[model samples]
Target: MLREKIFYKDELPVSVITANIVDYPFHFHDDMEIVYVLSGSIILKSGYYTYTLKQGDMFILNDRDMHSLERTDEDNMVMMLQMDLSYFERYYPDLRDQFFVVDMEEDKEENLSVLRNIMAEIMMEILQKGQGYEHKVIESTHNLISCLISDFCYVVNEDGKFQNETGGKTSKILAGRLNRIMDYMYENYERKLTLSEIAENEKLSIYYLSHIIKEATGLSFQDLLSYIRVEESERLLLESGKKIGAIAEEMGFSAVRYYIKHFEQWFGMHPLEYRKRYMGKSMTRESRAKYKRCTPMEIETAIHALTRGAFTETEDKLVLKPVIIDIGTAVGDDDNGQPKTAETSAKDPKEAGIFTIMERSVNDILAEPYHLLMDLGETVLAAGENYVITAEGTDTKDISRLSILVYNYDENVGRSLRKIHTENDLLRLVRHYDDEIEFLIRCNGFSGLYRIYRYRMDRENLAKKLTDSLNPEGGAGKRDMLIGRLTGAPTVTTNTYTSSDVLSVRTTFQGMGVELILVDRI
Candidate 1:
C-alpha cells in the first residue's frame, strides 16, 4: 500500500533514515528531504527527475514530491534527512516557492566531497547519540539546507524568474500577505489589535487570517502583539530612565500594573530591576567572579600558589572561573629543556608542584578537575615554542565545569600558564577578527542552543568582551553587551574545510533545535 508520511507539529520536525531497501512503492511526504548514498548504489526517482546515485552522490526532494527507491544493492547504505517545510516557513517564508536542482554529474567533485562529508557527519552524530547529538543533527541539517540554497535551490521571487519554480503566483501572494500582516503588527503593536481589523485591512477572511497567522508565526494575534509590545518596552527600559508608569502608558498599556506584570512575566524581573542590572555598572573581574558564585581572591590565590613560576599582577588578565581543580602535575618545562613528568617532578616539590597545599585546599573548596585531552589541530608541531589555549570539561553535556588551560611551551620552560573555569561548553575557536577571537559556547539549556563569545588575548590571559563591542576603545561596558546571540537554527557551510565568514551553530529551546549563523559583525 502507498503510504503518506505525517509530520506532527509538536515533534522535532526532523526524521533520520538509514536503511537498505529494494523496490519501494511510491510515496509522498509534506517534509523536504535529502538522500545521500553512503555506500554502494541506488536508483531513485523524484517527480520527473530520475537518477542513479553512487557512493557520495546526493539529491533533494521538496515537500510532497513523490519519489521511490527503484533498486539497491544488498550491501547498499543510504541516509535520508527529512524536515518539515513549516520549520523553514517561520524563517524563510519563500521556501515553499523554491525547488532544488542538483546535477551530480555536472557538479564539481570538490562540491560533492563537501556535501558527502557533511551528510556523513550528520549520520554519525544521529546514530551515535552522543552528548549534544541533537544539537549536532540540527546544525548539520541547516548546513545541508544552506548548501542546497547556495548551490541548487531556485527561488521564485515576485517577478518569477527561475526554472522549476513551484507554487508560482499563489506562493507569492501568500508570502506577501503574511509579510504585510507581520509588518502591520510590528508597526502598530502599541495599539489595540484584533483579528477582524487585521483581516479587513489585508482583505482576508477573519477565519483564514487567524489560521494563517498561527501557521506562519506559531502565535495568535493578541500573543504576537503582546510579544512585540514587551520587546519594545524592554528597549525603552534599558535605553531610558523614564518612570515605569509613564513608559507603560507610552507603550500602549492601559495601566502601569498591567505592563509591570507582563514585563516580569517576559523577563523574569521587574522593569526597574532589569534597567538597573543592565544600565548601572560595568562587569569587572570581581563582579563576574561574584556572579559565578566564586571569589576573585580564591581563583588568584590558587593559581598563584600552584603555577610556581607564572605570575598574574592584575585582575584585567583574568576572565571568568566556573570550575577549578588540581591536575596534580605541573605543566612547565625543566632547566634541561625537557617536559617534566608528573612522577619525576614529584621528587622535587618545587619543580613537580603543579598544585601546592593551599591550592589543594582551594580545589577541595571548589571542585575536582577532570583530565581531558587538548584537541589541537593535526598540523601543529609537538615540539615548538607554542602557546596553546584549550578548554576541558568533566562532562561534555555540562558547560559549568569546563576549564580553559593555557600551555606555554619553550625550550627551557614548558608548563601551563594558567587555568580558568567557565560556565559553558567550549566548542571551537571559530576565528580571530580584528583584535578579538570568537568562540562558540554551548549553552547549558535543554534547547541545545549555542552562544558566541568574543575574547581578547592579553599575553597569557584571556579577557571576555561584549560581542556588540568587539573593538572596545577603553574600559569594559555593561555585562549584557558581552555576548551576542545569533538568530535562526544553527548551521554550517558545505565546505567545512575552508575558512568562511559564516559559522554554523545549534541552540535548542525546550528540546527543539534552532540553527544560527555566527558572523563577524565587527
Candidate 2:
C-alpha cells in the first residue's frame, strides 16, 4: 500500500506553474512554492535573492517573497508549484510544522541523476496532457517531498535530538525566539546591534538574553555576534572580490588590523592570507582543527572549512565553481621482477574477461607482492611527487603525497590474498604500511595494474621521479603508499563476492582483535 505523504500545509491552494525556459519572469510569489527542475536549468528570483536551478533540483521559497527566473543558455525545463498558506495551515493543523524546513544537496553523480530522472517523469506527465495529470503531479510532488523529508530525518536522527528538541513546548518556544533573533541578526548584522538593543528587541534583560543564548547555542552573545561578522566577512571575502581593507570596514571592524586579528582568531588565518589561499575553495586542516566539536561555532567552522577560501570577505564577489575530477586507475611495477595488475577494467569489459581468467597466472607470477611500509612517526611533511607546492592554510604549503589506488578486487580474490598474507603474518606488515600511506579506492575499474603509484616525500626529488613514473610506459607498479594508513573499507565487487569470502581469512594482531571493513561496490 502506498503511504500518504505529509506536507506541512493542508489548507493552502496548490498553484502549479509550467513554463518554457524563455517565459520565466523574475517575480516573487505570495504563496510558498516548491520548484522541481525538469529538462533544463532555471533561475529563481525571490525578492532580492536569486538561485540557479538545474534538472531535478528542488527549491522552496517562502510566502510573499519576491522571486523571478532567468533562462541560461543551458538545458531548460522547469516545473513550479505554489502552496497557499491557508491550505498549509488547514492541512497541517500544527504551527510547529510550518517553520521547519529541509534542504538537500547531493554530490553523488549517479544518485543525482536518479533524482533528476524521477522529477522528469512528473514533468513528462504534465507535458503529455494526461487524464490524471493533476493527480500525477501531486503524487510525484508528495513522493519527492517524502524523499526529502526522509533525508532530513536521517540527518537529524543521527544525533537523535530532534524529537526532544522540537517536541517539547519550551523547546519550541525557544526555537521560535532563536529563529527571530537569527533573522534579526541576518537583517541587521552589518549595522551595529548592541547587546542592549538586542535585549530590548527580545524583551529580555541583557543578562537573561546572554544566559539563554549560551544555554541554547553554547556561545556568548558577543562571540555569536563576532561569529556572524566573521561568517559574513568570509562570504564577502570569497564573493565580493573586494579589497581586504574595504571588506573589513564594511563588516564594521574597527580597523584593518583589528579585522585581521579577529579574523585570524576566528579562523586561524588573516583575512587577506585566507583570501589568497582559498578565495574560492575549501578550508585547511588548521582552520578545521581550531574549533571544538558539536556546537554552532563548530558548524560555522565546518561551513567555512567546507567552502574553503572560496567566498572571500576581501572581495565582494561570488565565485562558485563546479568541482569535478575523473577517478582513474593507475598501475606500476617496483624494482622487483614482478608485475602488478588488477583483473578487470570497466572501460573495456572484453579486456576484463581476459584479465579475470589470467588472475591465477598473474597471482602466480606476482605471488602476493603487497608490501607494507612502517609508519615513520610525525615526519615533518617535506615534499610530495607530481604536485605544485602552494600555501595551504596560513603557514603550511601543500604537498603532493603518494597514494595507493584501490581498484575493484573480487571479494574472493581480496579475501584469498588476505588469508594467504594473514597465515604468513604479512597482514601485520600491510597494516603497518597502511598507517602511513593514503589509499584511493575506485570500484569502477577492474584491472589492478592501473592502481599502482610510487612517490617520495621530498618535492624536488619526488617530482622528477613522479614525472618519470607517471609516464604511461615508464611508471608501472612503482609508487608506494604515501603516509601509509589503513583505509577503513576495502572496495569489494557486489553479486560476485561477499563477507563469507572474507571470513575465510582470520588472523590476530599480537593476540589482539582486529576488525576489517568490507565496503559495498560503489
Candidate 3:
C-alpha cells in the first residue's frame, strides 16, 4: 500500500533510528530504505523475496519496494534508515528513474561492508550529537546514495539479469525506462490498471508501452500489475484491521478468492494464514504498550553496545539544580547563620510569622467521570538520619546533552558542627549524617573529545552573600569513579578531554547543596 511517510527532522532528508523492532506491515513509499540487523534476527519480505536476516546483515529496499518486517526471536533490534531520494532531484533529476537493487546471492560484500561502517558512523554521530554531527550525517547520507547508485544500480538485459558495465549509455537508457515503469506501478497499483490505462497515462502508444514494460522488467503489463497489487494488499491484511472481503475490494480485486489466490501465488500461503501467522505476534496492544523511549544517555549506551561491545562519547547549555531538601530548617537563623535580633524576635506571633499576609485564589470545583491517582515519591526514610551524596545522570529531551546533578545534603552532627554550626543554639540537628557523601559516575559508555563545563552552584554562599557564585570544575578515564567532595565556594572552570572511554567523571561532594552538572560533546 502507498502509505505516505513524513519522517525527517529539520529537512535533513534522512530519518534514522535504532529500535527494538518486532513487526512492520507491508507498505511502500517513495523513500529508499535500508535495514540493518543489530542483534538477534528478523524475517523480511521485500517484493516476492523473503529473507531471514541475522546480526551484521543488511538489506536495501528500493524500486519503491513493498516490504514488511517480522521478528524471528524476542530480542531483535534493528537500525532502519530511510532516505527521501527526492532531495537529490536538484542535483540529478533522473533519481526517480534509477532502480536500486542488491544481489545477496552475488559477491558484493566489499560494498556492503563499506555501507555498514558508514551507517554505523552515521548512527554514532546522530545518537552522540557531537559538534557538527548534523553535517556529518548529511555527508554520510550522500556517500550512501553514491554507493548505492554506483554499486547496486546497474542496467540489466531483457531477461532482467544484470548487464556488464560495458553496456554504457544504452544500458542507462533501458535501466531508466524500467525503473520509471516500476515507479509507475507502485504509484498506481491500487487501481484496476491495464495496458491501455498505462499507455494513456504515459502518453505512449499501447504497442510501444507493452514492449518496454516487458523489456524493462521481463514481465508483461498485466503480470506486473497483478504482482504489485498482491504485494500491496499485505499491508491491509496485517495492519488495516479490516475484513478480507473489504480488503480485497479496496485492493482492486474483483473478489476475495481472486485476491487470496494472487497472494498465495506470490508468497506461497493464503492471505488469512499469513495474517494469522504475524498479526497478533507484533504491533499488538501489548507490544505498543511495552515500547518505551530510551533517554539520550541510554540511547548512546545502546548504540555503542550494539555496534561494538564497548563505549563512545553534544552540547547544549542546561543548568542542573542540585538536591535541596528544604530551607525551612534554618528559619531561626539569618543568612550569616546569625540569630535574629531581640527586636525582630519580640514581635507578636501573628504579626511576625513568615507569611504575615496570605492570599489564596478559590476556583469552582468540577466533578469528572474518572479520578486520578498520583505518586509523590518517597521523600524520607523511616529513620530520622539520612545523607544526600548522589550522582544523577540526566538528559535533555531529544538532544545529545548529558547532565549530572550532585549535592551534599549530609546533615550528620559533625558536619553540622563544622559547617552550619553558627546557629547551634538556635536550631538543633535531628537527621543521620555521614562525615561526607560521595558517589561515582560510571561513564564507560562514551569517549572522544568532550568539553566538560563545571557548574558549581553553592547554595549557602548565594544565600549568605547574594553574590554571583558558580564553582566550575573538570575528567576521568573509563570506569573510574571520581568521588564528589564538598568544600569551599565553587569557582568557574572548563576542561577538554580528548581521549578516554569515559568510565568516570571522577568527581566529589562533601558539604551541603544542590545543583545540576552538564557534559557536552565537542
TM per candidate comes to 0.36, 0.27, 0.42
Q: Between candidates 1 and 2, name the one with more favorable TM-score.
A: 1
Q: Whole-model Cα lDDT per candidate?
A: 0.44, 0.38, 0.50
lDDT of 2: 0.38
RMSD of 2: 26.5
Candidate 2 wrongly placed segments (more than 4 Å): 1-12, 22-26, 40-50, 73-75, 88-118, 121-137, 152-522
Model 1, runs deviating above 4 Å: 1-3, 6-11, 72-75, 156-502, 508-522
What's the CA RMSD of model 1 in angstroms? Answer: 24.6
What's the TM for model 2?
Answer: 0.27
Tens-place lDDT digits, model 3, residues 1-522? 234354688546778866666666655566777888776788987654578988777887664565678887567767788887766454335666566655454525665655565677567667766653454465455556655655666655554444435213223233223455676777877777778876787677898777766654445677778777876787778976899899888877888888888788766688888888878554332232222334556555545654532211221111123222211112266567785432233333223211111111110000000010002121211111222111222211222334444444433433333334232211223122223443333333243445555555443432322211212233433333122232334444454433222223423333433333445666
lDDT of 2 by residue, 1-522 (tens): 001112433221344445555544323333455666644676665433356777556665544333456677774545555555543343124322433322334333332333333344443444454432443344333333333332322112232123323222112112212546656876777777787888898677888767656643445777667666776787788777889889877887667887787677756677777788776685432222121123333323332332222111000011112111112212455357453322211233233232232244323212211112112121111111101111112111121122221122233334454345222232332222221111112222221111112221211222233233333333334233331111212222111111110001111111111211122222
Count of residue pairs whose backbone atoms collide, per candidate = 23, 85, 30
Query: Weakest 10 consecutive residues, lDDT, candidate 3?
Result: 363-372
Candidate 1 residue-wise lDDT, 1-522, digit = tens: 112445432234567666554554445455677876655688876544457887667877666455677455444556667786776454346776666655676555554554555555555554555544554555555556555554555553534233333212222221112446666876887777778998899777887777655543445667656656776776677778899998888888888988888777655688898788877553221221111212334333332332222211101111112111112223478898886533234343323223331143322211111112123221111111221112233222332222222221222221211232221111111112112112222211111222333121222111122222244435545453333222111223211211111124332221101112222211
Q: Tell me the lDDT of candidate 3.
A: 0.50
